[model samples]
Target chain A: MAATASLQTAPVPEGAPITVCEVGPRDGFQIEAAFIPTAKKIEIINALFASGIRAMQVTSFVSPRAVPQLADAEAVLAGIDRPEGALITALIPNLKGAERAAGCGVDAVHTVVSASETHNLKNVNRSIDASLKDFEAVFTLLDNSGIAVEGGIATAFGCPFEGIVPPEQVARIAKRYQDLGATSVGLGDTTGMATPATVRAAVRAIRAEAPGLGIGLHFHNTRGVGLACVMTGLAEGVTHYDASVGGLGGCPFAAGATGNICTEDLIYLLNESGYDTGVDLDRLVGAARLTQATLGRELPGQVLKSGPRLRRYDPGLTATAAG
Target chain B: MAATASLQTAPVPEGAPITVCEVGPRDGFQIEAAFIPTAKKIEIINALFASGIRAMQVTSFVSPRAVPQLADAEAVLAGIDRPEGALITALIPNLKGAERAAGCGVDAVHTVVSASETHNLKNVNRSIDASLKDFEAVFTLLDNSGIAVEGGIATAFGCPFEGIVPPEQVARIAKRYQDLGATSVGLGDTTGMATPATVRAAVRAIRAEAPGLGIGLHFHNTRGVGLACVMTGLAEGVTHYDASVGGLGGCPFAAGATGNICTEDLIYLLNESGYDTGVDLDRLVGAARLTQATLGRELPGQVLKSGPRLRRYDPGLTATAAG
Candidate 1:
């Protein structure tokens, strides 16, 4: 080869260990039309926990009338056998939800604040300032409850109702959450409007503002750039990511919103890219299959349908001899 | 509003202009079981050309018995309205295919060689060495035809029959293609087995061996890392990419292979990331819609369903006042 001498240069830097926070039970189930049986939900959650996933958002403590699909959040959270050192989180919309989640002994409670004011009003029935007040109330309610709080800024990239969300707006909300005692903050592409540039800019802006806060990303595969956004986030030193099994999850309020990044697929990417996630691929696929069985339909995960890339095929002796 | 002080730093660099080579006509149609009418193929290609796409892989001149979907390669080449300054290319398997393409006046003729020997044998019924010999014969046939040649190395990242192809093998094939008068070499993830790390390593290795060659990428969204792999390629200074409109391509020979990176989605990413691709988003979506209509089903592209991110949403004065 004429120029093989220059091939000695390493192309990719070894990335740090990444934490994949499985949000299938909460985010994936919340949007399903058919109600999943409580037992089936517990089964899937248990299977996912047994798959060596260290963290997960188990369910959301929202109003039963608002999200009937996850109305059995309390029962589902209480039924699963909590693994040692696992961070089991729950989505909470208000101080009441936070209190209920803390009572359920969840490791963390996640709250949402939209970067777009129009989206914030539509999503939480409050302005950004009102949401900040609610977050303060939630913090007060969770005081000394030993439960960590994660502030999630939705539509951090762009909004369906408001075209381009300013990164400065996201940074302001993130800073307020940090000052209000949030342990971490997550940026969400609620409408799947994020590109690599916007994702990187959002991360940098938020990181520059909340220098000491842990940052995470929740991406939708709506535009098919979910993993690409994750790659840019990784390059910018983001380690916490939220993914769904079987590529499940979508927003009913957000038009054209689709599934979140598939957990198995994200794991495959991170593992192949030299980032340790400590999750078992086979077990994750098993969980995805169980999900499909429960849902009575095929899911959108690639690794669930196509086995892992490292799977070996026995070409037999004749093929080897030919090679 | 606490942390909006330092929002002036640009997070993403202004990347160089990128070339998006639309391959829906050839790669997308190749695996489709239903035969698209030849007129419809020409219609979509013409629409794509009018959408400001500067290059496209129009069709493949392969054995009709092998791929009946694209049997009308010559008719399609003659029918499409070739735009000024557009580089319309065709996929050619061997000397005969190359001669047919040259006679049809294609701007370029593309050939394939697999990095995995098993994949090579399965794809073309020839060994790697035999494929090289065929390339040589094709080069001789097109020597004075004024048609450039593109050598596409299939299974360049990993193979279903042979797991984890070595970068050295890909570099060797690329080197030989460069020596044999290939103006460019495209690395194909035929099975969608490439991750960012492997994609970067392959690009670096291949670039090392063939410094003067124009390198392009053909990615499959099989494992959901298609765009991520493209992001890595962009970081490594690769300017050419192959995307299928509506993400409508899959490799029948490569088990579990799915659609290619969607052209509309790729343009959205590149344009949003500050790279000029000279593609019209709305017209591209129209072409994708035409493809979906032709197939009598919805395709996998998100931009086709969600519209572009820059699409303005009229919140009305009432909504703004409420916010």
Candidate 2:
């Protein structure tokens, strides 16, 4: 009943390995109004990988008519360099998208369904059962192609249209995905209604029902608790988190709000908190700068604007304020 | 050797009261570029008090020519309405500032000294020991006046001019504050160089050195992990935290950055995380809107734009993208 119910969690060991999955190419670019050039998208994706991002959702395999921004997904997948042992993934909505991704060089595909029934209908014009049934076809096509499947439960924390989603619902869906031979399940906080309470509830419920399924958390910074939620995830023994370069996306409901948590900031937090994310902080910031230069505006990343924690300044500079 | 040394902290109980100290009037307004009218500052401070802010750093008693924006500290303290059992405080720089606060209706005075010698010299043109020596007179006057003293240690986590401040340095100054009969001490993240490793080390050292002194944390969101650092503070059992309304302050060194952690967002996180701060979320958001309207532009607060967590939207609203 309380958010602090799961406060007594295991300590993440010093140098504990964590997987920071980059979802900017798919989740961030999909919502961007202007179409990012195909070559620029590949350049940013390659830069992120070169910075030691082993797992990334590079692009979405969707119809060009629907999301014009991600129309060149196939070309991007073909043109990008693959670092050894890197796992490139993409978002697939249906069997057709799955087939397209199979022809590309993607190692995995993330399939999504909304946990809220109302939101499920609003998002995909279908019921939860219908969406799950459709995923079966996607699973069959991908399984035959020997591609990994990551079940995504959107609105897993709270729904914007209908608030206070039940944890049992998320668990029940995760169990279904587990039965469908999925490798992992991602809890997506779309629209950023997640708090420590909902995150703990969903995670605990899924652990009980789908004990074999791996858990990943994808949070947006819409209400500004994204990284705080990440802290709780670490305490709860969740090691995989999704982040976007430059905090690129935005919520339609909240103006001037950032969508995904920033990549460089996450790395800085993890490295300082005794976790080994295996990502270079400076290289990640360089990629963020590249994205910012391409977009021609300041992103919502704080560490991007300010250098790392130990960065020194000239003693001659004027001190601004008393603490 | 690790930042996770204090990860095995006890849980903060449900309905456990947390002290949310509002520091925007002093910390945020003093650095604002324009001179906010004295009446307008009072209106915002009174509105914040009406929203159940029990403690506040109302203004700074500095020279008018130095920080003209907060020149009306006396007027602002007199004009604001005080709730029952409210503790109104002010930043006192010297014996003169303490005498001014003693005459005004201030419950307490916060005297500051930087832990880093270079920063202390740059900020106040004095060495750390000399600054501490000067505070002795201010403490004497305030002690006689029955005003509480909260000693502040600037650059407690790290310093910009001198990177990687030693936790022992912070503990030494905090012990000095204890000797001076201070009730509580604040660890200031001056220049936003704080991290979980540094926060843990400093809090642990202070607990060992001066167990009697109550601890308060003042963190800037300049590095995007301000709330994440607050998570570390909670794990360390540090309860009182200082935040600014509408994220009003800015880092002079880092462009496009915010200074203090936003007060409304902190309240929301605490409330959801099973702590009772005795502040209404909607009312706090309302106060932020008032501040934003008065400033004639948007503030950096996300909850101010997004509303509360359980806020519902129209189901008819279109979903922008698949999760």
Candidate 3:
């Protein structure tokens, strides 16, 4: 029977708005081969905004020739109409990318550094120290441009090359970013090698080291543990999450890496658990469907295919709880 | 970084041995057209036993014509030698089936009942009460027969025809079975429609009503939430999970349901998290590989395809902790 009183006793402090930072348009499109039209990118962002996704990573400001899929980043950013109270973000690899993102009138600029020295060299062709030095310039550029800057640590959980990243190394890089005046830090399981226990340990260690910093998570469901890690983050008192629409994303290092946790499905999960995420599941699914059609392939997010559980059922068959 | 003082804390008292019960040779083979040789089943069972899988739902003692795949159940059981500590289980539908299972000299006889009246009617062409009445005869036949009896609650999570199942209904049936002196209760999510929240609620309610009953879980990863549900069961202190070796089972109702969670991967998660499941990953993966070759189709288990996380690295490059 449906409990007359809800069994949801674990209450978070009242009136905390959990932020769902959308990374699909940037992260999702980057990995896929389909060179989506700039208009399609704008359309997807507009759709996300309509579905109550206020903050979105619209496009990456990387070198156009480097990432041809998002070559029209500036054009796409300019094409989408910004609804009221919406924040658009972009990824910046270096000072040049930061300048490009700041010029696009985006709300925030995200720069990333890999925790593993091997992955760091492969990712950006620079050592960890050299990447940090490069980021110093990117940080100064974003700081002078009056735009919010966020530091993302990729391969934070475990590295495909190095394997089993030590927590102290991740914390050390995070601390360095915090000292460099980053507004927030995003931890990425770039290869999806994290388990719940590892996630818990990492979160505990990071919180002990950097208590005041705003922390977010970017997880790829490569090994199918992305959602579990997300739950661990929830248990660790994290309120902000990063997800790609249609679960679209891939690791450059690991072959056959799966998509990120689907944004539509994640929204459905959070909203069903009495967490207010503001995103409309149906609208998100519609955008996901559009993206799937544009890509000409099936995406990994199951909720879009199966539909949400509670939404499909007739109220007469299942008992509704008395509020 | 490794804690200077080896962060290996005192082992938390393991709640109970989470039975990685295998039902593949029975439940998995029954629906397939592939007539696996009797020797193959014996080989599979012997490999599973070697992997420290103590309890195995080896075969179903159904009529030969009804399930031709398991028609050689008797021969398969006779061919395999049971390890001293293993609980070799056989599924029984009625008194005749129980007698047949007893003739096979198995450790336990498992019987199933549907909580939804409509599903019970459709499945066995009998009402819920009629099925329960049949259970009475089976229970009477097994009493003092030196064989343990376990009851399975199928479609406990959600039914295709009836939709959502209430916790009270699940608990009431479990209570009835426990009151009738069932040795254990196994909850089956036949349709894979359960979320972690629903699992937590239903399991808690059942435990509250049927205290001291050995509760086990049989989850299908059809909806991609199977592992998440497993994590929920772990948190709620429920051990004894039933999984197919290569996630082999399928749903008759849902057209393209995903298979059960892979046993090797499940053991990898549990063992890596410091739970003493005692299953050797390499042996289990070898068995999975053999099954895949015998079936001539790729299985859904990740570790079988990609190997474990440690397998990703070269032996020379891997650290001792990961090894």
lDDT per model vs. reference: 0.80, 0.85, 0.73
**Residue pairs with clashing backbones, model 2:** none
Interface RMSD for each predicted structure: 5.7, 1.0, 8.2
> Candidate 1 or 3, higher DockQ?
1
Task: Give the native contact fraction of candidate 3.
Answer: 0.08
TM-score of chain A of 3: 0.90
For each candidate in turn, the TM-score is 0.92, 0.96, 0.88
Candidate 2 chain A has its poorest 10 consecutive residues by lDDT at A1-10
Cα error, candidate 2, residue A141 (Å): 2.6
Q: What tens-digit string does per-residue lDDT give for candidate 3 at A1-323?
A: 00010112132333445678889988888866768888888888888888998678888888778789988998998899897867678888888898888888987878888888877766777887787788888777767566777778887888877788888888888788878877567878776777777777766676667666667778777666676666666667777778998888865434544567779767765775567778888898898888888888878776666665643333234221000
Q: For model 3, how does the per-residue alpha-carbon lDDT over B1-323 read when each residue is reduced to its tens digit?
A: 00000111122234334568877777777767879999987888888888788678898887788778888878998999799878888888789999888998987888888877766766666877788778998888888887887877877887766788898888888888877768577888876667777787778778778776667778776656677777777777766778888878775433444566668767766776667676888888888888877788877675675556644554244221000
Query: What is the DockQ for all candidates, taken in turn?
Result: 0.34, 0.77, 0.18
Give the per-prediction TM-score of chain B: 0.91, 0.96, 0.91
Inter-residue clash pairs, candidate 3? A1-B168, B18-B240, B19-B240
A-chain TM-score per prediction?
0.91, 0.95, 0.90
Report the CAPRI category for model 2: medium
**Global Cα RMSD, each model:** 7.5, 4.0, 7.0
